[model samples]
Target: MKTTTYNIDRINHLIQQYQLGKEEFLTLLSEGLKHPLTWEAVFKEEIQINHLKRIDKIFKKGLSYYLDPTAPVTSKESSIFFRKEKFGTNLNLASKKIVSQFEDLKISLSGLAKLSDINLERKLPVFHSHDNPVSVANTVRELLMPRFKKDPKKFLNALIDTFAEYNILVFEYVEHPSLKEKTNIDGFFLQPNVIVLRRNQDYFKREIFTLAHELGHYLLNQEEIESMDYDQMAFGKISKVEAWCNHFAFAFLAGNELLNLDKLPNLTARNDYNFNEIKTISDHTHLSFSAILTYLVKKDKVSGAIYAKMRRNQEEEIQNRKEEEKKKRELEKEMGKASTASLAKPIQSPLFVSTIQSAFFDGVINEFELCKTLNLKPNQLEKYLR
Candidate 1:
């Protein structure tokens, strides 16, 4: 078999463009390829690709995580990400919306930042495509590199623990339980206070990023606006306040240090976002296979034309896999039992704290899972537990 080598400079450029690291870039690249797999796959048992494809529905109605405490005077525009996507009443309506909710964060970013003990020292690689939504979201992943632990569970536990500390409710995940839509994502919040998660979403790497993005909205007080979202089309057109919230998510997860665009060399064009490389990085960062590939295309590390083709390929693969699953489900359905799964750990009661020692002493699990399973993972669990 021929080996696919990556172009370091090109990979670096894409990493820089999307403020990604070698691991994050490779994970997404691999996911969208002929046989996408993240670096995490090496340690993880090979998982069948789950094709829970569906649009991300963000609600745009709740009012949380949007207040800027430090600012003495309230300002109307507390953000930098926006383009007038339409004219006429669209502009007027959007302007009115932005004006009304600029400095009204019910939640606090700095407070959450201070509360987070998950480690926030990763250097974010700079990406040139600051204007792109995908680029920005991927950049947020950079902020999380500093806390990278080989064990996926630990990373998630830390995130969830922090969310719980913040009074977020953790939800029991059931796959596609919602009649509204389906998703590959592990966790999502419904509105002012409803979080839906697929506890079955076991990919550690991508799950971390998803947790961060969704929580970012809460911390930045964009939860209400996101709740109002009726369609995915609201992504770029969301209020400036919402844009800032997303930027904060990207910045917090990816971090400013790692994302300096100056480091991106033209050579990153050769990162080769192939199946093997993706596996390498995903293994390192523990990101999800699907997210790893999505980030690569968004970063422009992979060609647009090629990315489109890969999307089609992924769809076909999903179709084939779904057919196989249908057969499995048909067979399994006869048993008339539900999937057997449990929380990583027994959730702490409404009481604010649980000892790390208690988890290990209980003999419920080993040392590693105990340390992380304090209920943290970032996205749905993060918000739910918060």
Candidate 2:
């Protein structure tokens, strides 16, 4: 049986929030529904359940949100949206949605923590831009050393675990194909303590660097949204905070080899720019060989021309790899086999997991709420809740 939903007010509010006019909203729905929709029908409560579900998908809010009597919150006074004047880069719709989702999760975590009497206070000390990044990096590295791992995947997972230990909530969201738009930004830090990263399957090393860079911002108590491009680090004019963060990330990742980086001789054709040594350091640090070379250029250890040539070579290599992968996928298709592509899963923060578990055990949140908060299935809840 068909049902009517008279949620015009909520629908209109979302339309306004998305900066869409009534006609535009209806047009968008029509495209998705494969039929023309009119605002007149919406006003008269003639919209069906299927229509409401379609609208809910667009808003990313559940259907129950529209059924509730209360309207969605529009105030941004307490949000990072209002607090941070500059994001360092403009966010696309997908990036903005991911950020908003994590912000909402942080709020929920805080509320649940309070109900369970959990002390979620951040422990890392804050520093100013004038502070020596090397000194700060050394201190933070010492703190995280206990969680250190050499392998790339283990290294990233270790970092996330370390961040959780310090009361910093780390969350990763994937740029899934089903999303209306993919997020261009790599990661961002939300003040008071939440860091969000976009999952990168092809290049996990970049994700590791981004995590350390955002950690720099956290230690400096500065909030920022950034893409973390190596090319920009080598050539672009950046603010003091950004430069500090870059240096901190480098020093933290390099560990004891930071001094070696400073003491290294200038690269010249005579020694082939010490490529072998650089590669060794890169492997140890899990930073890309190109990124390490770029850092050398930034420090004046390598000339701009050499950096540019090496960068071109690296780009060419990457392109060749992509072509190879494409051919392999095509071959797989011809063989009636599935293409082998890495499917990434978001890394869960241990602190975030335990907080929801505590909430569940204390009766602050029910079983359904527990699964929802943890983003787990009913069968998966036992591993966490137990």
Candidate 3:
């Protein structure tokens, strides 16, 4: 039996690099090796080939990683903010996996850009912490054009397109079989230009708002993960940054017209403002119902108590709607009919796709590599090629 000698220093370094304590490392080792206790001896002296293989698998690293002192470390630091609750240990792992995927995609896109001789520069507008949210929002809206804001779906696509034009990478994560229910984050922004959105949102309006909110983080260059509910945007509870961003998103989506309360129909002076009236405003502005209500509260048009009650009612309504949709899907399955819900679409930026295609045509990458990088099947390659 052949035995390989590993530098004990490197082994210890890897353990620290992964932030794995001795006890946790032992537990991970115990899953593979029957006599985990003996691994301590191997760690101090020399390891058998079989033991080395198991260790590599446990650490999720290549065998050569332990041998080479100059090998680059792969750990990345990320700060994620959950709007609902802090992630549990399992959920944290899931969130990290998502971040890792983003990192990998960014690296691939960056390499493709370099090979294609494309210049990727940051072109997003910058705003100070104390900058007026309404002014910033108007600026962004003008830049994005008010025409795209007419339809929520069109608005979202156009927003992504605009961000891509500015060299920002925006992606929507479709809940595929492999990634179902692993993470519940609504959206997240990664520094230097990467934003991700979950594809299973109940409302396109919510997605639009989230995109705007994440854009806020992008402008401020703050990395965050958020569930981003209406309560988080409430006047008193939210941080200054969130408040500014929420206002910015409102202005961006609702436009300067909504800034004038007189434009809205007279409120009935009822505790909760009429839902129908709010719905009308939402439809006309292409803004979410919650956004309208939040603005009302901010303007002191709606009482805090009323706003809170409305929020709860809205949440209940959303829950009921989701339940109804779930049952509807189940019924469709029974009837052998396709689901009403749309399938998750690929979320690659247009620029990213074009760069990859160009690289493929230039023979910098082959068809297989292109398909793999784009997360596409063989059939999908033709669409890009043409």
Candidate 4:
């Protein structure tokens, strides 16, 4: 077998770029290559073609990249890892990897768009933390809001479609259930207009809220990688930019109904926390009950104790629902029915889809490149091509 010798300098540069420690990279290589190869054997010695191919798969850059001696070190300034000191939350390895994955996709999309002569520039006004969130939300709501739908999925899709019309790219990612390290982050907005969402299969409403929150960041022209927690809006100390985004998301989702929130009588022991009114608003707005309650808490209509108790109950209910769902899935599997969750694909932005299609049709990228860029298999390309 003709062995391939990977440039040690290129391998070292990629490891550093990914922030992978030497031992950690070696362990990954060991698992991926399926051989207990020592550091010296990989860097100082020639590796088999199969091993080199596995290394390329792990790095995700083409095999040619690792073979090139002249490949320059990737600039940290272009990466979120080095550019942002804070991301509104601590990013774990999975979170960082997910972000890096999308960042690379964004770069690919930009190049494709340029080649295809498709404009991906954001068509929205930028605002500041000092801007009035409610006013800003009202203005943006008019432009982005879709006809309300009670179903969370329909509403989310509609919002995403509206976003595409405005040239705001929304990409969703799904983590397989078997993955050991899962991302804790909900969503993030990248500058020059890209928003990435984590698919919340259990609670589509959370994904809806995440989309709105990331949109808030986009409008501010500020890049933020964040985990969306409504409780933080009520209790945790947050930056003004974060607060502005939260309020913006609320007002954007609630629309004219926000005016009525101020009018609702404050929650008290005698009022039963105005359950009926809150439920009605949640149904009409498609915002989660907890989200509405959190806003009420911010308005001082709901006491912290009341908010905490309600949140606890809601969480318990969600947990019970999850348990029920698990049993139901097990039952379905036993009965030989396909599980819908496993079949679900991450939502793709129409703008992104069109860009890739154009790139392929224009001879900018080949069929294999299209499938790779779209994360589809060759057989699955036909559905997307249409």
Q: Write the per-residue lDDT of candidate 3 for residues 276-339, one digit (tens) a residue.
A: 7678768877778787887887776777777777778888999999899889889889999976
Listed in order, each prediction's TM-score against the native is 0.39, 0.85, 0.77, 0.87
1-386: candidate 4 lDDT, tens digit per residue: 56866687877766765677878777777884456778777555676777687677666678887778686646654676655667787767678778878887887789889999999887887899999999999899889999998788888989999999999999998888888879889999887788999998878888898899999999998899988878888899999989988899989988878877779999987988898888888888877888898899888898899899999999999999989988999999999998676447888888988999999999999999889878898889989877
* Candidate maximizing lDDT: 4
Candidate 1 Cα outliers beyond 4 Å, as residue runs: 1-154, 165-207, 225-271, 289-299, 318-326, 332-386
Candidate 2 C-alpha error for residue 343, in Å: 3.1
Clashing pairs in 2: none
Better of 1 and 2 by lDDT: 2
Stretches of model 3 off by over 4 angstroms after superposition? 1-70, 74-91, 149-151, 177-181, 260-272, 335-343
* Overall local distance difference test of candidate 3: 0.70
Error of 2 at 183 (Å): 0.2
Per TM-score, the best of the predicted structures is: 4
Order the candidate numbers by lDDT, best to worst.
Answer: 4, 2, 3, 1
C-alpha RMSD of candidate 1:
21.4
Cα lDDT listed for each candidate: 0.40, 0.80, 0.70, 0.84
Off by over 4 Å in 2: 1-57, 63-78, 177-180, 338-342
What RMSD does model 3 have? 5.2
164-230, model 2: which lDDT tens digit per residue? 8889888888766676678879999987889998887767888888998999999998899889778
